[model samples]
Target: MSNETEPAPAAHGQPTLKAIADAVGVHVSTVSRALKRDPESPDASKSVRRIHRIAEQMGYRPNLMAAGLRTNRSYTIGVVMPRLTDVVIAQTCEAIEEAATAAGYQILLATPPDEVNAQLQSIQMLASRRIDGLIVSSIHLDRPDMVEEILRAGIPTIAVNRRADGKLHAVTTDDYHGGYLAGEHLVNLGHRRIGIVAGPRHASTAWDRTQGCIEAITSRGIEVDEELIVHTDFEVQGGISGAHRLLNLADPPTAIFAVNDTAAIGVAGAVRDRGLSIPRDISLVGYNDIPLVSQLPVPFTTISSPAAPMGSVALQQLLRGINEGEMSSLKLPVSLIVRASTTVPRQN
Candidate 1:
């Protein structure tokens, strides 16, 4: 034998359940039950808090990968959004996280490069993670394959703001009512010639909102000039470009309604650039009532999409599906908010 001694094998990292049990002076099974906050366990709340505190002090992290392999569940939900930069999406995501945590689930978020690919990648990643469920908040929902994939994974999936073509459950706002409200508000303000800035044609929300607005206007005997209705991306640049096209018409509309707040802001900027005073020259309305709308130089009249409630409802529905195998779609109501940007048009 050599004089040099072999180094002792490095001590393995402490297992989370074992460390929690040792710190709490309880059996590993009790630690597991306590950490799960099982209702059947006696004094589970107190035991859970005690175990959680000890686990934190010991720098213990649960081996989710190994647990997922064993149980076929990660106790996590996959949340996908078109873009985290969008204020409405970000707020909804925050609410989703809170709701998931309250239900003892963690969230894994994915923002895809584009709306179409985001849906595909998010579903695939979540399936690979063995997630308990998924919540999709992106705008693209025309693909039937997305629904088939989710069903193939054999996990619950809920769509928000976009409805899939198949039997998949969905949670969305009443887009038609939102559009009708916008149209009625403009009509009541004595606007006869109204223009619309709609989102992408493929988005169901855009189609429904446009239909509602057209119906409301036509029912009141107001003519909807086909040329005044423009469909574009739900972004500021789209608003700017659509507004330019509308204003260039032989007889421009007295009021313009944008499908979202970002586009409305763009319309407002474009109108100002042309030295036109809002309501006096052109009235503007927007949807989704994002926080930024209220803080603008002229507060925008908008339809509140109830994003937080939608998120909470979606999570609650997902949990139900996870525990009871129930799946159902839900449509939350929308409310119109009158603000400074809309007014009676001034006669030339």
Candidate 2:
């Protein structure tokens, strides 16, 4: 017999197949097969059950990277999400991560600028890592080149938050309906002259919301003042600039509907600078009832989009596409939240 002493497994390190096999008095191949088999299966062999018990005691975890090399499946998901600094985006990504983890997959995330070139680079990098699937959140409505490249890659893909001009499966909020709700609320409050802090037109989310708001206003026999609509970035500064432009108009609107809560905060600042107050000089409505909006001193009247659910549903759709060669688009519903920031327009 050889005189070599058995090596002890590390206390804080991952347990290897050899370690588990040795503990179970079996060969490494047997241990590998046992690990691959479902431990909870009612028909598992007695030997398999014993191996699993010992493996559990040793805290063994399969080497997915190593197995992927042989199986040709990385079992990893790639995510290209921009504006992660935004609360809504952050919440959505967190949900995606949670869902991916629960589904026995890991995510390789890239948070590049929302520009097409930058996003393309990120996608390329993720592809190099052999991602099994992809989720994109910043697809521009006016640009289809990057989306075409993604489709050509033949990897299962899903879009979230924004659609790819209907070129890809998407999980998004009903932004149009959300905008309509905001406009309808303001109009019901007797504010006929309304202004819109529309976001960039490149994003379908912004354009759809703008169109929906306009539809609500015009459907009520109110002529929308084209001059009242200001398209800008989706940031607070954009909101501030748009608000100033609308307020400077010859006939300023009595109500302002900002496409996002962050922008609405900026609009509020502009109102304060103009020595005006919300619902007094201008009734303010915003989309996306982020947690901070509800805590604001003048709580925002906003549309509550399902950010977390969108992420979760996107993951499910991508998995279906990856496994069953099936995919479909989804649009989660949104609701309007009445808060202190909105009320009947002040009597002139």
Candidate 3:
């Protein structure tokens, strides 16, 4: 009404698809097809690149939620872990999240403290959020009740880090072979009296590693004394207690194998507390070579489970189940990493 220059129609701060189309000299449909990466669009590849470049320059971000309304999908996956405090799971989940974002999906994370009932509640809650699939990074061993809940919910799921008994899909390391490698390494170092710090007795990891170690030891005509093996939580305190007990035995072991890195660190602490030195008094080996293990004062010899590849493969399986009704269990290989922590025993 006044001489105020008509306000320039109040510059729209948010860029829209139409703005991108007009800027790139294309129709809105062509802009959309370019944004969606639809190959069949009449828009040429160079035009698509130009549209994308302009969209970025204009600060245009796609509304995934709004697109989801038309697509009937949340384009989100739920990732479940026992605890993010655990380095192995945290790093692997980082890889999964990165890969998922690159593949145009979002991730919702949950940690239920490794309790089956709590996990069931978590699954139900994530399902209510309409997550497209779930990646359970930790599973309680042999919990049929939990497995039943997951199946009944009708959600696509892939187990990571651990696996079920062919009941559901999983992507995990070759734990059996990993344990065998640890055993063969120690046994080949001329260690006969070996102690085991096996993680939770009920878990498949503990069972399979135990069996594989036993097999490898026996293959060399060495009898594994049942009294030398101990099952405990995969924590520092648990490993300390187990290691202390083994060291106090009538025929103390010359080498100890812990099924987890945390426990292995604890065993190392136990050795030092007793005024003993590694490789001279005792040798130690760990599984799942978490980064911190290598940085320890006495770096642990360990099995390098492919954490990144495991996460990638798990997501791949989940996507396949979501898109093609196909999911299969997968086992990736692991290799042993030798370091200062393991060597030939003094007596040998």
Candidate 4:
């Protein structure tokens, strides 16, 4: 007597929507809506509640792959990022995943080495899987090829953390401002001879921060010693090596500014090995006020970048591009968190 046509049994003897609908004496569409309704909503009707209970009893489960075929949308966002082991990168990914879930999308993540060739392969693989969109975090500044590949895929895409060549839309913190703040803070403390643990040249984030710091220093009529700027990886070991080089100079820097907290930790280690104490032998400034830096014996004076928000906003931007066919870049604000690791230079 049911008006709804019965669907075949789901694979492996699993229950289908029609089965739940037949149990509840309603249309399959109604059952589908009931199952998708938010459980926490206060306005769920009695019939919807009854449908959920019946579906549970019938062991009904939705098949996402089947649903994708029916709707022509995978409802999946591909995320290609490097350095998942880094805490800051991990935090950003967590935010992106959380936002994607809330928006009824799943995340397919691929973490390759932060190199252009490796990333290109990862992006191609994700595109082949028919992802609805892509989110990238480790875009290199000099690689137009990567940007071209992303455009060639013809999917809605957005870059987070670092941007590539200004060709792709991105959501990033104001790295330049953050660097300027670090430099200004050091200059205010009467530290003139400053050393920089500038990260790799190919990253926009690194360049922006380094340039901002240079601007702040030069704006105050202090020349940035070309010898004082050392390019290194955004890792602790890179920090240690760079710091040691600066410390061993004929006229070593009285203050060191590391572009990231991880590198700053390395600088700290190197300083300790040299039998020098922070704010006594050399003042230090670091970017990205990561949680661990705040708890250090000499807490880092660093810039607080909005890593999580960058991920969240990047998702929103990608969604807009997908639905509206338009996207715009955004730069979030950053602030300086002064801590115990910095002080005025000692009198020579």
Q: Return the TM-score for candidate 4, rounded to 2 decimals.
A: 0.83
- Across residues 1-348, which tens digit of lDDT does each residue of candidate 1 receive? 745232222146655576557656789998776655523223447667666656645665556667677776787999888767878777878888988875557999888854676678777887788689999886455666666766787778888877775477888899999999999999999999999998788787888888888888999998898998999888898899889888999999999999889988889888988898776799999999999999988899999998888888888888778866987798899999999999998887
Q: What is the TM-score of each predicted model, taking all chains together? A: 0.80, 0.84, 0.84, 0.83
Q: Point out the worst 10-residue segment of candidate 4 by lDDT.
A: 2-11
- Residues 1-348 of candidate 4 have per-residue lDDT tens digits of 847343444456668777778778899999888876533234668887777666666666556678688878798999998999888899999999998875568999999999999998999999998999999999988788889988999999999999765689999999999999999999999989999999999988889999999999999999998999999999999999999999989999999999999999999999999999998989999998999999989999999999998888888888878756988899999999999989989887
Ranking of all predicted structures according to lDDT, beginning with the best and ending with the worst:
2, 4, 3, 1
User: Which structure is stronger by TM-score: 1 or 3?
Assistant: 3
Candidate 3 — which pairs collide? none
Error of 3 at 27 (Å): 11
Which sections of candidate 4 miss by over 4 Å?
A: 1-67
lDDT of 3 by residue, 1-348 (tens): 644221111146757777777776779998987786522223338777666667767776667888789878798999888868878788779888877775568999988878788888888889999999999876767677777778898989988988877788889989999999999999999999989998886677777777778788989999999888999888899899999999999899999999989989889999999999986899999999998989988888999988888887788778778766888898999999999999888963
Model 2 collision count = 0
Q: Rate the local accuracy (lDDT) of all candidates.
A: 0.81, 0.89, 0.84, 0.88
User: Candidate 1: lDDT of 328?
Assistant: 79
- lDDT of model 3 at residue 333? 92
